[model samples]
Target: MGVVADRVVSILLANGVMGMRLWFGQVRWVYRQRRVWVLPAVIVLGAVALSWLVPYLDRRWAEELTRLPTGEFAGTFDASVMATVLSAVASGTIAFSGFVFSVVLLVIQFGTGTLSARMAPRLTQDWVVGAALGTFMATFVYTLLVSLRLGARVEDYQPVLSSLLAIGLALASVALFFTLLTRVINFLRLVKVLESVSRAGARRAAEVHPYPLGSQGDTDVDLGPPDRVVRHAGRAGVLLGFDEEVIAELAARAGCVVVAVPAIGDFVLPGAPLFEIHGGTSLAERRLRRHVVFGIERVVDADPAFALRVMVDIAIKALSPAVNDPTTAVQALDHIGALLLNLSGRELGITHIRDRAGAVRLIHRCSDWTDYLSLGVDEIRYYGRDSIQVIRRLRALYLDLLRSCPSERLAPVRDRIAAVDDDSAAFSTAFDRAVATSPDWQGLGGPAPIDDRQC
Candidate 1:
């Protein structure tokens, strides 16, 4: 009765988990990619069908085993005991196999078929090792329990174990053979034309280069800013992006035309070169040097009035300790309010100081950042969580400048202004410099160029 109850409980629990997963997936149908529900629905239904079949199979196996006569043992193979043992072994084996299959399927589906793709190779390696150890431990425990229950020594069960081993080996051999044959055929099919096609595509993409808008590049005679150029056609690529900000910054620094204005939030797309640096060989060699750093350029869609209110709050904070000039702060706030009145019914885009002497702040609508964010892409390419450090450093720099330096210092003002630039160049440069000594910096975007003409 205990064993029967356990089996029923396991079946019910498994079915319940599966049903919940299906329910969650259905709830997210509007947000997720279309038709993702069909396969999972089929899989859940199949699991439900198998749950019903399990008991029937257990009963049939029990009857078959009971029919066999026992010569040495006094007790017969009772249907309940036999069914319980069989069910335990079958369920354990099936569940383990299902887990393995699901993992392999997910890896193949998401993995680029390379070791680097899917879950990290290091994680997958750990999982395989853990599974092997677990399998050995489980098998040893099961063998010990069965030996104790049947009142048999290990030697007595040697033949049964040998038969099981032989069957396992035969099945493994067949599977290996088929796997090898399939791989060989796939290789042969691809080897015929893959190289030529790959080379041709590469050549074609390299040949396509579209020019830019007027005065986008650095015009400084000594050291110019990057030339702006458009890297891809139509804004379609931002919809599938990993990080549009990185691309946008890269494009701005590269002085490339940004053709496709992404919506509010979106993902980066494949085949979209981050940016097309127009100077070609000259820029390509120093591509790592021409970076434009923009710190967290977050796009929040709220009422213009609310945004103006936030700016007012910031201006008050700026005047508190740093500036200590309530009159100037109040004056700036008044001007901002009056300017905002010009945007009562329509959308407005503006960047200004949050405080009388704080970081440069921009509050605008219809900027490139909003366009990209509207596409639903939130990934940051160059800047990351570490960007907080960059802002803090800039604030510190501002404090220092105020203490000893002149009020009209252009560099400090430029630094503050760059912090709020839609391009985010000044913030990026400072961030890259701060993190250069750390190992984690390797993951961030490259350093900013020495040129400041474009600013």
Candidate 2:
């Protein structure tokens, strides 16, 4: 009976855990990706329910407001006053919704054309904007519902509280509408967007890969031989995160270290080895995959490189011959430099995840300083060969990074500087080389005097 009970508990746990995986998948699809309408749908439904409840609630609670003397409370919840307010809220909100959507569409176009196209797709994940949009739609719906309860007869009831609530929502919607415009404008500005994305990435990177105080003892990172491999299942997507606690249970039972074969944000192809169980002879592909989440885009939760990916994409696109927008590339380098400065002093390539018994359960691979430097600047430095502003920004970046980086990491940055020198040397004339020789703070527009000391 004990054995049977144990088996039953295991089955229930398995089913419950798998259900969590399914729920997470849906969440990632509806809210995690670019689908921004889910919150609005929920808000509208709630508003409809509240529309019915508000009138009943007012009649039950606020009959005194309805019965106030007309001389003292001329503008109170009279039938005409209620009708006018409801009609105004409904029409004003509908118009406001249209205007807000138009602004969003315009901003999307501006961001896609001016900023990184890759970054533009994730704008919907900004739930502040989502909630704003949802409020406008919900308020419109609420007013319409409340307007239906009105009667033509003077003796009929007028919903004072409901009309007052509608007025408040309308006011809130107006504020949010303007707030949305401000947010959209900030997002539209290329520098602001780059800074925001870079800062978010840096903050997340620091959280996930913080510097260890003294030493982290007894971390057995060197599990000898991989005895088994677990391949990917179902459809392919970017590996977003892992349920470390759940995986720890599986690893404890199996008595092996589960190494995530693909880095987070990496595109996992079908049949690719997702995990390598070191020091164990068996692997459970189905059970393990449930804890490994995948999504259409990279999330910053654990993936630092996703931010780097976005920065590089923008720089590369700006450096394209068709765009020839070197200033934009330089602007990207400014934020990238700050991120690198933040990363230079922190611990990186932090791959170990420990279980309940303080045993290593999972390994997550990630990029370090060299990798970030390459991803952030190498392609742009190579692509923007003819652009003097790009080269100078690259110089400034290296100089700043070199000061912050440790002694061992200095050589690679210097090597990049040498490469910059070699690229500028390709220009035959001394004058043209001088143009590329200095860091141009002003870029192509108004040139700053050459600081030959640094050169």
Candidate 3:
């Protein structure tokens, strides 16, 4: 019977050690990978180490006491001394308990299984719950050990100390763990809902024909006055016209590609035109009111870099000799546009134009062009100030290219491709002024002519 009891104790001890090792190993691995959990985990691990060290130090002190003459100083390290020492130790353990609680909470955050496994698309809230449970279990075991140490003391006050420590650690561990896990669950659920709604809205918009602009089947490109008269079948009601070009430019500035084809504000109802394409020559006759194109007229007044970059991108894709990847260029232009907009204190009304404009205007204003129509001609004419720096830099680059290339050495074909001549005279003039006036342009080679061609 004694042998069986001994075997059972050994098994329990081994299990305890294994559990602790597993918990610490998993937690340390998680702490290393999860950027958010690093600070909290370090605090918890440090506390655990201190808790373990405190006991060892206490045992050493007790050994030294044993070596001294027993009765001579029997009460010297008296109840008061023990109380003070124990009180300090208790306080330290309590602080350490708080760290344990925090670790549990954070562990719950990463969820169960390996980090990679937890991140798998198939994994769900269950994994998070499992990790939280594991943390709670670890805390509980530590509390039990603390309780046992206090209970074994012969001093009458020790049991009370153990009970208090156990209760405090258990309650704190549970509270902290749930609070953090609940927060994680709520945040993730909110994100999921938003994602679902967004996907649904996009799908619905795609299914519908693009928002209609006019009675004639032809799409309107004029993005100016939303109330601008759109004539399709020679009959014209003020169908809302979004300047596709302007919106496209804004989209480009926002680092958004594809512009959603029918786009956000397209009126897809019957008798309305389909989505209009930007930079296509197809709309030249019917597309432009004057030399001014019908698509986003508001863009004409926006940051010129955004507008010019948009134009350059479009030109490259449609008509340039070579097409460079436009995504990076588009992002840079958008950042520039955003900076200019911010500096001006103008809302630019882009966020409104993109998403919640309907809530703001409430009626027929679906897009910026419609907003222009609803807001009246006065609002439509307001253009944000241009970034002169970007314009000068662009002009300077164009001029330097021209100066480096000898027109005489060029085949007439390459020269023509460069689009040099009296027509491009502004290129050299702009470059020279930029180099002279702008400190940024100093190191660049002297001003040269540039073709500014698609090539």
Best by lDDT: 2
Return the lDDT, model 1, position 216.
17
Give the residue spans of candidate 3 off by over 4 A.
1-138, 151-157, 187-455
Which residues of candidate 2, in runs, are more than 4 Å off?
1-34, 67-75, 151-156, 212-228, 279-287, 300-302, 356-358, 440-455
Q: Which has the higher lDDT value, candidate number 1 or candidate number 3?
A: 3
Query: What lDDT is reached at residue 352 by model 1?
Result: 15
Sort all candidates by TM-score, best to worst: 2, 3, 1
lDDT tens digits, residue span 34-109, model 1: 2334433443344344333433343455445334456522234333343344346545554654565465455444
- Residue-by-residue lDDT tens digits, candidate 2, 224-285: 76788888876888877666557767887878888889986789989999988887545477
lDDT for each candidate structure: 0.31, 0.73, 0.33
Q: Please, what are the lDDT tens digits per residue for candidate 3 over residues 21-44?
A: 343343233323334344445544
Top candidate, metric TM-score: 2
Candidate 3 lDDT score at position 437:
33
Question: What CA RMSD would candidate 3 show?
Answer: 25.2
TM-score of each: 0.20, 0.83, 0.21
Better of 2 and 3 by TM-score: 2
